[model samples]
Target: MATRCDAIVIGSGQAGPFLAARLAAAGRHTVLIEREHLGGTCVNDGCIPTKTMVASARAAHVVRRAAEHGVTVGGPVGVDLRAVKARKDRVVAQSVDNLTQWLTNLPNLRLIRGHARFVGPREVKVGGETLAAPQVFINVGGRALHPDWPGIGEVRVLDNTSMMTLETLPEHLVVVGASYIGLEFAQMFRRFGAQVTVLEAAERAVAREDPEVSRELQSILEREGVAFHFGVRGAKVARSADGGVHLALNAAGVAREIDASHLLAAIGRRPNTHDLGLERAGIATDARGFITVDDQLRTSVEGVWALGDCNGRGAFTHTAYNDHEIMADNLLAGAQRRVSDRIPAYALFTDPPLGRIGMSEAEVRAMQKPALVGVLPMSRVGRARERGETQGFMKVLVDARSERLLGAALLGIEADEVVQTLLLAMQADLPVSLWRRSVPIHPTVSELLPTLMAQLKPLEEIPR
Candidate 1:
């Protein structure tokens, strides 16, 4: 007999687990499938593990400056790479185990461990066992894309997944992208005493962000000893006789050679669309291989939905959680949800982390809106000076006529936390006057909100 389910979720990643749990809580017979670990890449290879490494790097960085904190160490501060990896593994395992135990207790949800392929519409075959469900959700996430560079396969190269498993950090690590993953790993390894160099094909790193933010980040990274080769159109890699990798970068009609102990390919990510047999189920995918879904996340085929990285809908774990929330409501509560034109916030966890919500100055101008821009240096904030993190700035843009916050960009300590407040201001259509009137705790970075507002002038009078 084919195992039947009220709802079947393929790929037990962020979206899959989330929706499955919701469905089971709603008393639906749900089954979640996973070919590997339960927590998916975020826990196993992506967010959790990467953040753990960042925490380790942060500890090392802080310990080096412990003297500034008036703490005297008796001996030399050192790190054991083996112990770090051990702790990372332990953390990953504990989270996965907790999730497994929680899911196991849900009587309405069954966990299946095997590779699944579409046998037909509404039917999947897992290792020779056929399962059927009326409604199916595809949530397989993305994988790091490895570009075709000559001699790449012959040399020691690592993708985002393989990079996190490093027992001993490389002496010289070359990163091949300027995206979030590339930038974060490059800095972390460099802080761990590796010679780190970032190669970006674009004119600037983090091109998706505002130019000012990118420039500030570049300055910070360069000050911290990470070298960047920008405007490189292509690269060729060859193995040196001494076990190092030689990279020939083509930029400005010239080729330059760089040697590094290991190369990291963080160019981008590709949706895991193959082997699931989308065509068998009569589903459609975009040219880039992302599954196409309507506003409700419903695919062309009825009773089928796709979410998370597989749908190419902003590859963040939080977005996946949101997708699950909206998807469950659409599925069970008969609510119509559309993921269009949302006020999403993003953070780049570099030194003096960068965070942003909504449009940039360029974007606002290109859209032909009169944008009033305001900026205040972190130096002006009392807390920034006291905490010795007076580098960077806070900026806010408001529509000239409506005085509501159109966007905000923060680059400094606690940027990740501060961005949420900005997000709320934007969502609630709050004005800069409100921000000015609100009193934040004294001697805190949050007070920079009013500090920035004090420097604003109307955009109408500014001469172009």
Candidate 2:
């Protein structure tokens, strides 16, 4: 006999908990199933833990550069990696515990700890019991891809999740993949006193961005003592008797090897949908194994939906949370919200983060719209200069004829927060003409945005 519910939510990821809460509050009996920790990847391995350690790394960096700011320390700055790990663990634990408590206490909701495999379109089986529902939501999220690259079986490796368990910093950390996750970890470990090397299959650091963006980011990482070897499609690894890792690489046909203390395979992420028995539920997945969802995030099956990383629409935590908002609004409030309504916005966490929104320069150029571009270096920003952290640039694009904001890429001190000013204007459909006229608070990084707008030129006039 199957236990019936009003709705069954799979995976307690970014979208699941809040959506389940709303469903339960509306008098539906909601069952949320999980196989592991609460709050999914962000609270466990991805955002919270990584950012906590990034904060520790940043602290170490600030202390190392204290001499530049005329702050004299009595002794050499040293990082306690164990202490850093402990602090991260504590913060993560607090978050997980709080979320777990709230979910368990949610009225009309049942928090089930088990793996859910869909037996039908609107029903799932967890452990020895079957759960049937009229509606089902899948938010299973994703995990780091452990590729069958050469010699992968020979050496111990760390992905994003296992890397968090590190209590000691690596002497030399070789990170595979030069995208956001890989670069962030490379910089973080480098700041924690690891000699870091990054290997990318592409010619550039972040291949998806504008070539200039990639170049500047690579330069920043290089200046921070992180080595890069790009255009490497394959690598062979082995562990020595002394516990050191040896990586043999071929970058554009030139072969090289790196003897390092650790290896991190930050290649990519695969959706957690593999084990969910989507075929049994008659659900459709993309070639990459991501759940296929429409604009409203509905799956192929009736009354089924997928959200967050598993849906392939977006990967960031913010996107997943927004997915929850969209799902809730559409289901509960009768609004016709959509996944397409979202503008792409995310920040890369480096020493100085890169905040990006909307189309890239390449995308804008391909669109062939008459666009105006504005560029500014961090050196010119008052706050960046005053903080002695001027090391990047800001670039924004606008549709020339309409004067509407198009896109922005900010890479510098407080760039993550600074880019929001442009994000809001773009989302609100505010024109750059009016945006530039407003007086912003003086001496801040964002105030320089208006100054940036004043320097707009034809997009083609700007060199990437």
Candidate 3:
């Protein structure tokens, strides 16, 4: 007999698993099919493994600067690359086990591992098994996009998938692209004793962010001995006579050569929409291979939905989790949840760790708003002095007319936790003055908030 279900989820990543669990808990027969691991990229490759490795890299960085805090170990600090890889692997394995157990324990959920292809409307074939359902959700995430370049196959190049498993550190590494992945690996590898050179096609690193934040990041990375070639385009790689590789790049009108022991490509990720039989299911995809969905995450076809990286809205795991929740409520309880008012946040795990939420200075200008900007250098904060970490700044952008907090960027200690407070303020449309009046905990990095609020003035008044 052909297995029947009320809903079938095509991938078991952050969005797929959460949605599957939600549908099953609502008494719908939900089956989740995956071509790979249960937790998808977040647990398997993207978030869990990278963050775990980043944690070790951060610890290594802390040990090197430990004397400032008056804490000293007996001997010189050492980093064991093999041990770091072992620990990252352990964390990934534990996450997979937990996800597997959760799905198995769900009463109305069944997990299947195989490539699923749509055979017809509301029907799919997973290898030899055929399944039919009233509603089908495609949560298929993405993989690292490898563009065709000269010597692409001849030279060893690592993407996010293979980079974390590296046991030995290269003496010199040439990283392509200055996006999130490239910036992250570049910083981590440099801290791990690799002479890192980042090649960015864009004029600025993290061109999507505020110009001030991008400039600050470049300055910070340069201070840490990472070389960068900004405004460079068209990179070609060739194998050197020896065991190394030579990278030739065209920057504007000039050509430059870069030699390194290892090459990493972190350009970007493309949606995995091809060969999914979407054409057969009458699903529509845009030019970028992203599925087109409405505000409710519903495709043109009724009872069919798409979420996460597949939709290309925001690829963060937390964003996908929220997408899953919204989709579930829209499907089951008829709740109308627009993706607006979303405080989608990101944290770049660098030396001091930069965290951002909501709009930026550039975005506010683009919207033609009278932007009031406040910048509070961490050096002035009492907690920064106490913690001996005063290398970065906290900046806040506000709508001068509305007096509401627009966005915030923090580049200092505990930025990841600090962004959450800003997230709440932005989500609730809280006034910037509220932060100034409310007394923050004494001798904490968070005290920068009140200090920054007090410095609020016109964007023009902010000194560069």
Candidate 4:
């Protein structure tokens, strides 16, 4: 016999549990299904675990730089990989436990521990039981993309998830991609006393950012002993006789080889829609397998919605959480919220993190939009200099006609948090003059925002 419910939430990801809670609180019977761990990638493998490890890496880096801060350590700083893993495990476990407890306590909500597959437009099969509901929400999330490269299947390689489980640090870590994920791990392992080399197929690391920002970021990482090979092509990997990994590639028409103790492939991510049986539910997906959804996160099929990375909209946890809010508002509160109304925002958790909101300078130019731009180095920020961490710069862009803030890229100490203020300002549609006139607290990295805005010049005035 099949169980009937008012709603079905597939995959206990950032959007699933919240949506299920809202439905259950309204006295609707809801069933939330999960085949693996709760909290999806964010708690199990992605954000929570990686950020916890990044924090440990930052501590190690700070200890090594204590002398520059006038604090001397008697002995050489060393990283115990086991201890770091233990701490990360504890944090992840606690988060999963909290979510599980909350879901269990919710009335009219059944948390099913099994894989779910669509059997009809409004029904799914989980283990031996069948569930049917008028409303079904898919939040299955995504996983690391594994590219089809020669010898990849024969040789051992680590993805973002598997790399975090390592108990021993590699002597030489070769990262195959230069995206945010690759760079974060590259720097983290480098600070843990590993020789890290990052290779990117593009002309620069983070191709989406302004060329100058990419160059500056490369310089900062290089100063920390991280090697970068840009414009690489025809890359292949194989096992060497010394039990290490051998990577061969061409850069600038010169062929080279890299022999490393470990290789991490941080190419990208793919949506988890392969086994969902979306066809059974008549849900449309893109070429990349991401579910095609409307601005309100509704699929082509009625009563079926897709959220999170699987939806091909936004991939960040915050975006996924907001998806839940949008759906809940429309379904429960009679409020009309949409996925299109969000400003793009995310952070890279490197030592000097990169905080970005809205479009990048390159993106703005690609749209052929006339804009005014401002640039400020972290060296000019009193807090960065005081902390002996002056390594990056801040940049902002404004529409030439409206003088309204369009985007911001902050790459420095606490840049992640500092960029949020600009994000909020952009969201509020504040004018450039407002940012220029606002007085920020002294000796802070964010205080330089007003000074940066005050120096805004025509885009042409700024050097490429």
- What would the TM-scores of all predictions be? 0.96, 0.98, 0.96, 0.98
lDDT by residue (tens digit), candidate 2, 1-464: 89999999999889999999999999999999999999999999999999999999999989899989998987877889999999999999999999988988889999999999989888899999999999999999998887577777888889999998988889889898999999999999999998999988889888999888899999999998999998886677788778888877799889998899888988899999889999999999999999999999998999999989999999999999999999999989999999888889999999799999998989999999899999889999888889999999999988999988889999999999989988998889998877569898888998888888888999888865
lDDT of 4 by residue, 1-464 (tens): 67989999999889999999999999999999999999998989999999999999999989998998788898999999999999999999999999999999999999999999999998999999999999999999999876576777767788989999999999999998888999999999999899999988888998888887788888888999999998898888788898888888898678999899988889889999999889988888889999999999999999999988899898889999999999999999998899889999999888899999998887777778779999988999999888888889999999999988889898999999999999999899989898777888997888998899899888877766
The 10-residue segment of model 1 with minimum total lDDT is 455-464
As a whole number from 0 to 100, the lDDT of residue 370 in candidate 4 is 79
Clashes of each: 0, 0, 0, 0
Every model: Cα RMSD to truth: 1.7, 1.1, 1.8, 1.2
- On the 0 to 100 scale, the lDDT of residue 123 in model 3 is 87
Report the lDDT of model 4 for residue 172.
96
Point out where model 3 deviates above 4 Å. Answer: 71-76, 252-254, 460-464
Question: Ten-residue segment with the worst summed lDDT in candidate 4?
Answer: 146-155
> How many backbone clashes can be found in candidate 2?
0
Order the candidates by lDDT, highest first: 2, 4, 3, 1
lDDT of 3 by residue, 188-279 (tens): 88888789999887889999987777888898888878999987767778888888889787876688998899888898998888979998
What is the Cα-based lDDT of residue 80 in candidate 2?
90
